[model samples]
Target: MSKFKPEPFISCYGGALGAGVDEVGRGPLAGDVVAAAVILDPAAPIAGLADSKKLTERKRELLFVEIQAKALAFCIARASVAEIDRINILQASLLAMTRAVEGLAIQPEHVWVDGNKIPTWRYPAEAVVKGDSRVAAISAASILAKVTRDRELVLLHQQFPDYGFADHKGYPTAVHLAAIEKHGITPHHRQSFGPVKKRLEQLDLF
Candidate 1:
């Protein structure tokens, strides 16, 4: 009955603990959509909390550890490139967030989701714009998601040398576009994306 935060998600749900959810890799041309949910301890002090995009990799890695050590519960989940292409990126992102939240050992009373749109889930959810920076729990979740996804993309770089997955993490950078133009798309590349679609058109292939 209490009013939620004016941000994307409502504050806490009734009296249940507040869980924050966030994701990364939506804009990538390759790699999976990774998401994380974190429940921060109300008693804990949240220092140095900020948006994952605002922090350096070292900072995010450090905060990630702190969040893991302090959070009441947390979980990370991913939806692969194939799933993204099949379900569409938006749905895949929501699916990834849902999986992350559901994987929590205990269900949260309310979930504060980052971004303007809320996912279709049975649990109570609050959609917060820029929630990652506004909410400590969401910020922690963002750090976890970004760090985990970035690490995976770094590993993928070894498998696909031409696209420089490690460097750009499948973003449609000039290098990535050039790689698509030269070698065409790999299984990891999202063929549905614009850059990949344009490149395939030039080659007269799908």
Candidate 2:
């Protein structure tokens, strides 16, 4: 049997000094855009790793711990709903990613991003589609970003009990849509999202 090789679009970390960047919550009607950059420890082995979307919540939670434990350095950052509304989700996500990379304890020589569009930062980077599933470092980054965003939504549930944030995690589920239709959007809702934007238009609120 032949061993699988990474796709051309997917760039390796190149030795032990590269960073992986990924973001979560870009499509949610609520919650902040969260991003994570991870530098994996040379000795670490994160097996069965894939994109966070392919993993169950239980699996993601488990990997989150292991990744943090094995990472040489990691940083998580967020662009709030207000920021998202001001700059749009894509830019906000990029902003969050840039912030995460900037905040890392050790700077990286190169960065591997998990999407086709690279962030506007001055660092050298390559964006790979589905990179999170192919690159261990990107997978670790996805896990951390997802886990952090999930925790934030869970906390938001406490403040806005009507939204069921703990369960939906700010996704555009029918239940979440119903909640928005009923209770209207909270301050945490992304005002720029179409559904939330329409609701805000009707209510004439910022």
Model 2 / residue 7 / CA error / Å? 4.5
lDDT of 1: 0.87
Worst 10 residues of 1 by lDDT: 3-12
Model 2 / residue 95 / CA error / Å: 0.3
Q: Report the lDDT tens digits of candidate 1 across residue range 1-206.
A: 99444454347565547789999999989889999999888877668877899899899899888888888899999998889988899999999999999999878888899998888888888888889878888899999999999998898888888788898988989998888788888888777788877887888887
TM-score for predicted model 1 compared with the true structure:
0.90
Q: Candidate 2, which ten residues in sequence have the lowest lDDT sum? A: 5-14
Task: Highest TM-score: give the candidate number.
Answer: 2
TM-score for every candidate vs. truth? 0.90, 0.92
lDDT of 2 by residue, 16-62 (tens): 87888999998889989999999988787777678899899999999
Query: Hey, what RMSD does candidate 1 come out at?
Result: 4.7
Task: Give the C-alpha miss distance for residue 157 in model 1, angstroms.
Answer: 0.9
